[model samples]
Target chain A: MTDLLRFRTDAAHEEPAVSLDAFVEGQANASAVRLEAGDDARVLIPYLDRIMLVEIGFPKFRDGRGYSSARILREAGYTGELRAAGDVLVDQIDFMRRCGFDAFAPDAPIDEAVLTRSLERYDYHYQPAADAIVPVWKLRHG
Target chain B: MYKYDQYDQSIVDARVDEFRDQARRRLAGEITEDQFKPLRLKNGLYLQLHAYMLRVAIPYGTLDSRQMRKLAYIARTYDRGYGHFTTRQNIQYNWIKLEEAPDILADLATVEMHAIQTSGESIRNVSSDQYAGASADEIADPRPWAELIRQATTFHPEFSYLPRKFKIAVIASAEDRAAMRLHDIGLRLVANDAGDLGFEVYVGGGMGRTPFIAPLIRAFLPVDHLFSYCEAVLRVWNRTARRDNIHKQRVKILVHQMGAEAFAAAVEAEWQEILPNKSDVPRAEFDRIAAYFTPPAFEAGDREPDRADPDFAVWLDQNVKPHKHPGYAIVNISLKPIGGIPGDASADQIDLMADLAERHSFDELRVTHAQNIVLPHVRKADLYTIWQALVDAGLAESNLDLISDIIACPGLDYCSLANARSIPVAQKIATRFAGRQRDLGELKLKISGCINACGHHHAGHIGILGVDKKGTENYQLLLGGSGAEDASLGKITGPGFSEDGIVDAIERVTDQYIAVRQDGERFLDTYRRVGMDGFKEAIYG
Candidate 1:
């Protein structure tokens, strides 16, 4: 089991995540779901409002499929606890959060001080994404 | 050259700081090499076969004298006294220190430059036509748009981490000088029937294990929808591009497997979803950026250059091109001298080019995709003087588009990825054909160390791919491919050859081309006209 960092005010679910296949096939009654890198997030759109936790597996940090997966779920109105699980590094925290991952579950321990510093390093962004952070372009336009 | 705004400076500054911490952590053993690799690559520091190579972005291949001087300083201070300009219009220092990487980036930041997005899985430098504004045939200057795209793509939140590296090239003219069709996203600025300038977008074209000419996904995309439409394309590619096979992960493979039409349809669907967002930079923002690129005042003078010097006459015809404005010429300073390593520029040469750019060409210079330099706007009257200066500096090579003007990658000599060395092969071939390369006419001889095709052998008219065969270096020759408007992949001729044998084989192929080629037909044209049967027979028979 890995430690989870939750950012939402909603009641957290302690239930184990059902495999994406089981959940998509309606064979599982779980509210928490696990998404492998290859799993399509589009299939879970109908059940997004009901899901309390959605864990995206990053088998390797270099394999960036989970970033897109997290973005797709958030854009599709999956307001659940989007967690980035496995191989998550301190440097990738900011990008994962920008892609709508509000929770992190690293396979290895990350230094909290370094993670915090990295996250707060930049106040300006080039483009708007799954996050509410206003792009610098918007500031100029306004 | 686009100057960095407050937002731009902040982002770059923050990145340098982040990289500084990461480097420190690595030094302290807090991060492993596997973890440190991506972080270092994102900042353009690569641990190569011998040392760390730092690739600094020359955005859209455009840089001013100050930036060039800074690059010279970095080359002298950080590594050796030289740097290699890549085919992607970026510069790489061969012997960089990991400890000095952060300091180099900090130094780059002072000149409003950083290596952000120059490497890693995200977007590399957004390359464009080296002769952007000065070229006679361009519809509009492509650099402004390239700059806009550069800013938006720089440290882009969702796209910082991608399945594979993405490359974008923008061009505005009918003549594809920038290899527009050979990028992951190739944007050619065009005007519609309504006269509104937009782009004819091509996606998934790349040169690697599998070379492709990116299909036309959109015939005309309005300038307003540039980012949203791009987002759709990237998003689709991000989620759908194959991650299973490292070789098959480029967006080109996805487009190939899905078929062009189906890929376009998918992008269209995604575009519709994101259209309401209006993610592209506003008109005011574009105008602000465009203001930086507006050409300075020019004095009208004699259009015809004095051609009394025969050597000057040859160079004027070969190296000088007609600029958009009368009396102005686009000067191509070929880095390829006879027996010199392709793309290797000494600190002295870099500083000289900078001085020439400042004095003769409005303080602006461009690094060509073919590993040359261009002073985009020089008065025709100053041609003789400029030519004399280049001659003095050993920069006057009258071989633009000629056989001796080779494009070779730093192969086994520097790159860990290479199977065989490419520099010696290029030197041997160039030396062999030095006397007759001019007669050959427009032969794009490219070399790659391996199938990754950094040398762009796939797109070369006479291409060579170097590979490892049973612990020895082997070379493969290819023909009939081009990276121009009519882009096509080269086909392998026959059996591989040894280093010396490949050079001899090229001679035979070129000799055959001379015999069979019609009047005014170049190597590629002859290859296309007569087909591969003749060339293969010449090589084998």
Candidate 2:
């Protein structure tokens, strides 16, 4: 767990979310659940009120469904931890963060220094997304 | 041209720094090649057969003189002394090294250009007609809208990681010069009965191995609601478009599989939720972007015809197109210099063209989908002078839409994906038809070294596709395709040819076209009337 390059500022302090098998087995007591990349986020939307964490699977870095899943859950008013697990890498951390991925559990170890630099790569972004960073367009016109 | 403000400039500048760091990581082995591939591709870097090719975005086919000069500078410094303008109205440098890509991007940022999303499985550079603002038949300039869409989709979180790459083209004229019907999302800016501008949205159109003329999704959408509607379509695609199969993943396939009605229903349902309390672009933002694209000041005057030389007359007839302004002309500078590669322009030629653009075309120019450059707002009186300069520089080849003007992809010569060499095939064909170009009359000969159709062979009137057979390069010929207003896919004729044999086949096809006496029909028109049988027999029989 310590080897993972977590993008969220408070990722180290947070408890790990339950995997899909664990969640399914302990459905009544689970506070957090991990979902595979293919799992429809819409199904989890109804349960989002009580879920403290919603860990989405990446499966592969090139498979971008997790990004959409995180955005969907965030848009559906899920304030829980949206962790990107499996195959997450240093290069994807910033984009993952923008799409509401607050925690990461990469399958492989990442250089902490490289991950940190990648996260702070840009001060501004052009598109308005799940992140708090003000879009360049809003900064310009306002 | 849309001048980048502090924010826009900062985004591009920051991207350069980011890419520089990513390159460092890749070089240091912090990331594997598999990890670095998509990262570099998203930044418009490709590892080709010869070297890393860097594609720079020429947003909506428009660039100022400063940007043009910077492109020339990039060509001179980071790459070989030349760059290729692509069919998507973007430029690609074929001789880039991985180490120098960041520096090239940083240099491009100074001129408010970038390689961002130029080559990736994301929203590509939004293309419009090269003659977008200058064309006489336009209802309204589509540049502003194209710019708006470009800005919105630049780093869109949800869309950045879609199943496949998406392309959007906008056209305002009745004539679809941008090939609007052949995009993932084609927005035709049309006026309603009240004369207010709206979009005739077409979706799912594309060309690859599977070509589709995008069907009309929403016949007319109010201008203000465009962003939300577009988001709905993309949202539907992201969630539902096939991710399991890479080849069956474009929105076109989904549209076909789900049926247009069902797809429209899904989009409508999504749009309903998004319409209220939406993240759609506001009117104020639209106005702000639109202000940048306001027409340049032109002294209103009558058409003044100058005494033109015979060569100038030939060029005028071939390259010059109608402009909205009375005394202005849209000049297409042919990149297809006879027997040369179709779209390659040397650094010196680029610089000279930049100088010409500054002097005669209001300091701005456009890159056409046909791999030509446009001085979009050239005054009619200055045509002769521009023509003379172009002729002197060897840029003036009076073969626009003629037989010698071929559109070819960087096939086995550069592209790692290619099975054969398209440039040499194009070169030989152009040379074969060099003397008889004008007489051959308005034949679009497009060549792609593979089925990816990078050269858009599917849209060429006389299309040549390269293939691999038993470790040998083979060329397949197709006819009667078009990318213009009346969009149609070309049909392949029987059998493939060796490289020289293909050129000979093309010669025989043209010979047959000349033999069939039609009063004044163009090559495409004659082909459309005669069908593939006549051309097939002429080539194969």
Candidate 3:
């Protein structure tokens, strides 16, 4: 077991064991789906409710398709584990978490202390994301 | 000026603490240099040629007297005793140290300012017209929307790791002082036939090796839906922009390869999906932001305008801009001293300008996209006093929009990416045209040390691009470009020239314009009327 830190508040109590079964695209009966940087996230929307974890690949640190993929999966009502695998960095922890990513499988070892501190860097942000913290504008007016 | 509320205050304070930690980690050898590069860049710290350059945002070119004084303090204490105001409406210190970066940011946070997003592949500071609120010809003040956009785009989650850096420019006047047509996303506040305020949206306009004017994507979009529509556009760009090549990753390349019509269609499709509930700026939120921009109080003024001193009259003719109010005038402080760098100001000059702003222009000043400063609401009666003070301090150069007022990037001297030296060339040209600028009349000379076009070379009446040809510095000359309401790209005329040869070539081109020009034709007009052949013949024949 990879001592993974699950970030999704709503999905924390779910079962942690998820077999990495390969689900080829356009195949009908695979259990879970995987996405590359070039693949469209909408192709997995129909199977989101049934999928256990949707693994998105970040081939390079600068390629940001995983962030969009994670947001799209959550927007399509996926409550399962959305794991960001490959080439993830410690600095992108908060961004990945706010974009609806629950678990990370970075290519390098992540310092848990730095990761925790990074996620708590700003309690509030200017834009509304998947995180539940109120945007600063709402806090100001409300 | 927009004052920071409690929420704004807390956000900036938290960011300062966060960057402090990040800088600590980077210096402690915890994170690798590759991992820490983007982190520092997002906070506007760049590893340049000599040292780290810190670019602090001015937030739509508007700053208060206290903020200006703080900037002066930072310049005096942190780095050297000067700062450079860039063409992007931000100020840069070229000699910041890595260790003191956190303290500098913490000090900036006291005044609700930060270096955040001034660099990196994120949405940077949203710029607007420097004369936004005070211009007589404006339809409405555009700074409110600029502020709102800045708030919305700051640290946006999805677009943070963008394919390339993004920029947005907003303008309300028919005159294009802000160079709106040359930004990634340009918003013009326009009125429809029904007399409702709306935005005319333009996308993919940029200047680099490949220069292009933005194409209009939406003729008119309702003002209430501005944020949602912008979200839709950025979302579309974020999802589909080219990621294979860093050079081809800007939204401009997407717009070019996919065609504007196809890009617009894609954005519309994304917008249709996003508009239902993803993004919307509530009426209360809009009003709350707009409240900060309500016009300042004005008293009844004397009907007669002062026209007494000849020196003051000359300054008025060159530097004073028309105000929306009759008795008030907008004063533009020229940063382009004769044979000097375009926008470098010393610590004392910064403090003096701050004091001048507090006393003469309602405690606020604006930085123009052309790298000049503006005291937006100066009374006509105080013009003489202000002019005298400016003259004493060496800030009173009477060359607004003149040939000597050049826009130049900090080229080979400081920038790690420069191909040739731009400052020396600019100095040479300015000195060459010092006494002849008034006669030259309304000529904009722009210089870029490389093809990145930071000085907006493509938009100048005369554009000079410095290139390294076979281990020697060579320059290419272009003519007939304007960043005004009638925006057009300049055309290159034949071959390149050496540094001295290029200056002489420019003079030759101008001399031809002077000889064959009809009554009262500006350089651009005469070039447009006579076309490129006349200048080509003058230079080569």
What is the two-chain DockQ of model 1?
Answer: 0.73
lDDT of 1 by residue, B286-322 (tens): 8888989898677887569879899999999999999
* Regions more than 4 Å wrong, model 1: A9-11, A27-29
Best-fitting candidate, scored by TM-score: 1
Candidate 2 on B416-489: residue-level lDDT in tens?
Answer: 99999999999899888899988888888889999888888888999999999899999999998888888989
Best candidate (score: DockQ): 1
Candidate 1 chain B worst ten-residue window by lDDT: B272-281
Per-residue lDDT value at B397 in model 3:
95
User: Candidate 3: which docking quality band?
Assistant: medium
Candidates ranked, most accurate by TM-score first: 1, 3, 2
lDDT of each: 0.90, 0.86, 0.86
What C-alpha lDDT, on a 0 to 100 scale, does residue B14 get in candidate 2?
A: 80
Choose the strongest candidate by lDDT: 1
Candidate closer to the true structure by TM-score (higher is better), 1 or 2 = 1
Chain B, per-candidate TM-score? 0.99, 0.98, 0.98
